[model samples]
Target: MDIQKSKQLPKILIITTGGTITMTPDSTGGVVPTLTGNDLVRSVPDIAKYCECEVISFVSKPGASLNWVDLLGLAKLLNEKLADDSIHGAIVVQGTDTIEETAFIFDLLIQSDKPLVVTGAMRSAMMLSADGPANLLAAVIIASSNMQSQGTLVALNNEFHAARYVQKSHTGHLHAFSSPACGPLGCVLEDKICQFVKIERKSPLAMPKNEIASVGIIKAALADDDRLLKNIPALGYQGIVIEAMGAGHLPAHYAPYISEFSNKFPVVLASRVPSGPIFTHSYNFAGSEMDSIRRGAIPSGLLGSVKSRLLLTILLSLNYSPEQIKTEFHERTEY
Candidate 1:
C-alpha cells in the first residue's frame, strides 16, 4: 500500500460519516458496520497512494440514522474546509440510504469550487472482491482532477453525478447510483479525466446564521392527511418539502394547509415519482400547482423531496422572499 508520498499530490480531506464502505463482519456472521476514520483509511490503503488524504472522523452512524443534526454539523464543518486553501478538495464517505439528502444539503450550503465529492461503498469491506476501495480511490481522483472547481459532485461505481440528481437504486450492488431523469455530468477512467458537463460559478452564498434547532422531511402519499401538516408549523419546523404526486399535486386534503403555510415559511413541492422534475399545475385541481404557486409554495422542478428540502432550508436561512426563492431555484438548475 506504500507509494511515494509527495507534497505535490493533491490534498483531499476525506470525511468519514460511516456507511457500508466502512462496515465489516461481526462474530455472528452478520455484517457489523463499525469503523472509525482511521479504520476506514486502513481498510482502503489505496487512498495513501492517491493524495495527501486527511481523514476527518465524525460519528460513524449508518446513513439511515443520520439526522438533521448530523447534516448541519457536517455542512458547517465542510464550510470550514472550504475556507482552507491548503485543502484542494473534500470527500464524504457515507451509506447510500440517506447520502443523497446529506450531499444535496451540503451542495446548497457550501459553495466550493474545489471538488467536494461524496462517495460510499455498496458492498462491505469484508465481502469477497468488495467495491469500497475502488469507489474511494475513484472519488479522490475526481476531487483532485482539473475539474475541482466545479460544484459539488458525488462519485460512486465509477460514475460522476451532480448533487441535484443522484439517487440510490438498489440495496446491494456495484451500479446502485443513478441520475434518473438526467445522465451523469461525467465519468471517471483509470488515470484519466472525462467531463461531459459544464457549471458556471455564481457568487458564493454564505451559510445562514439563523437559529434553526432542527429540520425534518415529509413525503406526500396517496391519501396524505393534513394531520402532519396541521402540526408542522406549530412544531416549529423551519421548513418542509412535500413529495407531491405527478407534477407536484398534493392530496386535495393538503391544499388548504399548503395555502396556509406558504405564507409562513418555506414550503417546497417535489414529485413522488422519480424520473422527471416536479412541475407546477400538471393537473387541473381547483387548488392545483398554479394555485399553490400563487400562494407562494416553491416548486422544486426536477429536484426530489430530499434535495428540495435541503435547498429550501438554505433559502429559508438566507431570509429569501418567496419570489426570490423561486427564481433562485430555477436559476441553479443545469437540467
Candidate 2:
C-alpha cells in the first residue's frame, strides 16, 4: 500500500452525485447540495497522496428524485471515463436511499474490468462526527488497490459489499449498509484491504433504448382487494412486481385477479421477507406461492421487491418475450 512504490500511480476518478455527504445548511434551516467534487477532495487531502485524482460534479439531487434517464446518463459517463487507458478505476458518490438500485444498474451497464465503488453518508457534512470523509477515503483506497476486475462495490463503514447483494437496512446509522444473503466481500484496515470472499462477474447488459417501459409495484396486504390490480392494464403499466405476503401468497380473493392480470402482462411474485427466497412449494392453498406460479406468476427467487421491479422494467424495455423473461428469472434465481 505504498503510493511511491511504482513510478506512476494509478489514476482514479471520483464522480460526485449529490447526497447527504455533500449537502450544507441553507438560509431556511434546511440543507441542500452545494458542495462540489473539489470541496469533497479538499476535505480529505490524504487521498491525493494515494493516487492521482480527478473529480466531476455530475448531479445535485436527492436519490429518490433520480429516475431511469438520470441513471442511463450516469452509466454512459462512467463507461466513457473507464474506457480511458490512463484511468484505472472510478468511484461514485450518491445518496444512500437509492444506492442499491443505482449500483446494480452500474453493475449491469459497465463492461470494464477496472473496479467501480459507490459510497455515501447518512449524516450531513455539517453534522457532528460527519462520516463522509472517512467513507470517501475508504472508497478511494479500494478503487486504487489491485482489486480490479471485480464487479461494482459499495464501500461504507470500512466494509466493502458487492453491488448485487448490498442494501440499506437502517435509516439513521453510520453502518446502514449490509448484505443479508451474502456477507461483505472485504474490509479496509488501517493500511491494507482484506478480501474474504470472491465474486463471479456477470455479462454486461446492452444499453436500454430511450423509450423505456413503465413498471409498477404493489404490496399485498391482509385484506387487500383487486380493484387496483384490475386497473393496472388499463392504466398503461407494462410490468408489475407484487410484494406478496409470507412465502409469497395473496388472499384467496386475489387469486383470480392475479391469474387474470398475469395472463395480460408480466407479474412477478416476490416475498415480503427481508432475507429469503420466494417459496416454491411450501404452501398449496388457493393463494399460495405454488398456486401463483401455476397461474403464471413468475417467482423472483431471492431478489427483493425493488430489485425485481428494476429487472422487470429493464427486461420489458429491451423487448424480451414472456418465455425469455421466465427463463431469465429461473437462471438468475438458481442457487
Q: In order, what is each prediction's RMSD in angstroms? A: 2.8, 2.4
- The candidate maximizing lDDT is 2
- Give all candidates' CA lDDT scores: 0.76, 0.87
lDDT, candidate 1, 1-335, per-residue tens: 12337888888888888888888888887765687767776766667667887778887878899876787788889888877988888889898888777777777778677788889888888888888888888887888777755667888878888777788877777888888866788887875668787655444566777754344577777755667877888888876777777777766777777778877767777778877876664566754777676667777777777677667677777787767877887876535
Q: What would the TM-score be for candidate 2 when compared with the true structure?
A: 0.95
lDDT for 159 in candidate 1 is 83
lDDT of 2 by residue, 1-335 (tens): 12333447788889988999999999997978889888898898788767888788898887777888889998889999999998889999998899999998888788787989999888899999999999999999999998877789999999999987889999998999988888899999984799999888676777788588888898999877788877877888898999999879898877887788888889999878888789998899999999999999999998888888887888888899999889877776654
Off by more than 4 A, model 2? 1-7
In model 1, what is the error at residue 143, expressed in angstroms? 1.7
Clash totals for all candidate models: 3, 0
